[model samples]
Target: MAALKILGKSSSINVRKVLWTCAEIGLDFDLTEFGSGTPNSVTTPEFLILNPNAMVPVIQYEGQVLWESNTICRYLAARHQRTDLLPQDPMARAQVEKWMDWQATELNNAWRYAFMALVRHSPAHRDTAAIEHSVREWNRHMSIADLQLQRTGAYLVGDQFTLADIVLGLSLNRWRASPIAHANLPALQTYFDLLCKRSGYTQYGANGIA
Candidate 1:
């Protein structure tokens, strides 16, 4: 099979999600930097042809073009038959996917404002009130994850580290990197330590790009 063709900048958390998944699956890929700082990227006609949304982290494999970071991660895991990352059992898969979706939706929404303000240093995101609100919301949603970690006493879904952990771990890295004050969540701290032991997390996640 042809190696997967990934289109995105390496610094992107979403791109790192796919890279880490490939590492776990032992899949080879050729990545082209095509977003943010890359000249004539995302907005270029060629890139828009690949992803109409003009987002980073687009992948091409076996004549199939895929976007959406979490979806790409799921597809790669399923395609490679890495059942440990993405289970075959419907209920078990749902358990993993629910947390992934929560990370992409609820957690992402909570942190976007503050992240753009503090990390990206966006002029439009400089509203002090909005940043504080986003930080509070981000911490609150993370507290939910901390509670789940307390329950499972291991990975997000259970003892096995699934695709849920890949996404959430990156988010946790971002939370730690952001300039906002953090809540005292010992469970989350422990969870971060546990994920750090994984090679994938160390290479792509904890590599300090967060």
Candidate 2:
């Protein structure tokens, strides 16, 4: 089989999610950087052909083009039949997918403005009030994750680590790195500490990219 070709930069959290997933599955892949502070290849005609959204983390696997970070992780896990990473049972799969979706949608959306303003320091996102509001919301969403971790007392779904942890782990790193006040969510803190022990998190997540 041809090695998977991942098009994204190492500094990208979304791209790192895919990279960490590959590490967990012990799959080899080739990565091409197309992230911030580079010659914007994502907008180029050739790259745009692979992903209409022109996003980083677009992948070419088994002659099929795939985009969206979470979706790419799901495809790779399922394709390899890595039931440990992505469960085969329907309800178990849904449990993993639920947190993945939350990370992609609600959690991600909650932090955008604040992240751009405080982390990226983008001038266009300098609205003080909006940044404060975004920070509060971001913390609130993370609290939900903290509660879930408390309930599971291990990985997001249960004892075994799954795709949910792969996604949420990156989000947790982002929250920690972001320049916002955080609540005393001990469960989340414990969860983050647990994730840090993994080789994938050491290489791709805790590398101080965020």
Candidate 3:
């Protein structure tokens, strides 16, 4: 191994998705604490030059500098022939990307509400009304996910795990840990539990710092 570096803290769900992707590809990594003003990505001038946003996850493998959680998973998974997790056929890959877009556009916003309400805000300080609104949004989004899963095989897109699963699976961590109630959605619960069973996801995504 020629020393692969991952710039992000384990407490981040976005970063955790990349971590799980790396683990899925059997790639070893050296993750450093960055972002959230921990002298991570934000402090380093070179990293800032690469990612102006100073996001948590910025991976350096060999000579490639990769940012964004979903893209990182794509690059990492494709490298190790884990196309089952990413798919090889162009159309299949596109379908996988569609689900990834669904995750980014729809699921990401819902997860942020859960994160802010449950992790960032204390229980007493939490606004019940806001929480309900957030929960309703999340519930609607998750219901769509459950219905999607019910229509598909087991994972998000295809018969096997893909970048979509890793991306959305990480989000499910926050959904389960938060006070959101899971009712009559056995399919989604099963998928969530399955993601937890993976050692990488269990170790990284289980407890998000924010």
Among these predicted structures, which one has the highest lDDT? 1
Residue 152 lDDT in candidate 1? 98
Clashing pairs in 3: 34-40, 83-87, 85-162
lDDT of 1: 0.94
Question: How many clashes show up in model 2?
Answer: 0
lDDT of each: 0.94, 0.92, 0.77
Q: Which of 2 and 3 is ahead in lDDT?
A: 2
What tens-digit string does per-residue lDDT give for candidate 3 at 1-210? 477788887777888888888787788889888877576547567878768887868888888787888888888878778878888999999989998888888877765655676767756537777777777778788888899888884888756777888777766666776766754677888887777777877777665532
Instruction: Show model 1 residue runs off by greater than 4 Å.
Output: none
lDDT of 1 by residue, 1-210 (tens): 977999999999999999999999999999988877786479878889989999989999998999999999999999989999999999999999999999999999999999999999999998999999999999999999999999999999999999999999999999998888999999999999999999999999989887
User: Model 3 off-target regions past 4 Å?
Assistant: 37-44, 122-130, 207-210
Evaluate residue 197 in candidate 1 and report its C-alpha lDDT on the 0 to 100 scale. 95
Cα lDDT over the full model 3 = 0.77
Tens digit per residue, CA lDDT, model 2, 143-204:
99999989999999999999999999999998998879997899998998899899999899
Give TM-scores for every candidate, taking all chains together and pairing residue i with residue i: 0.98, 0.97, 0.87
Error of 3 at 124 (Å): 16
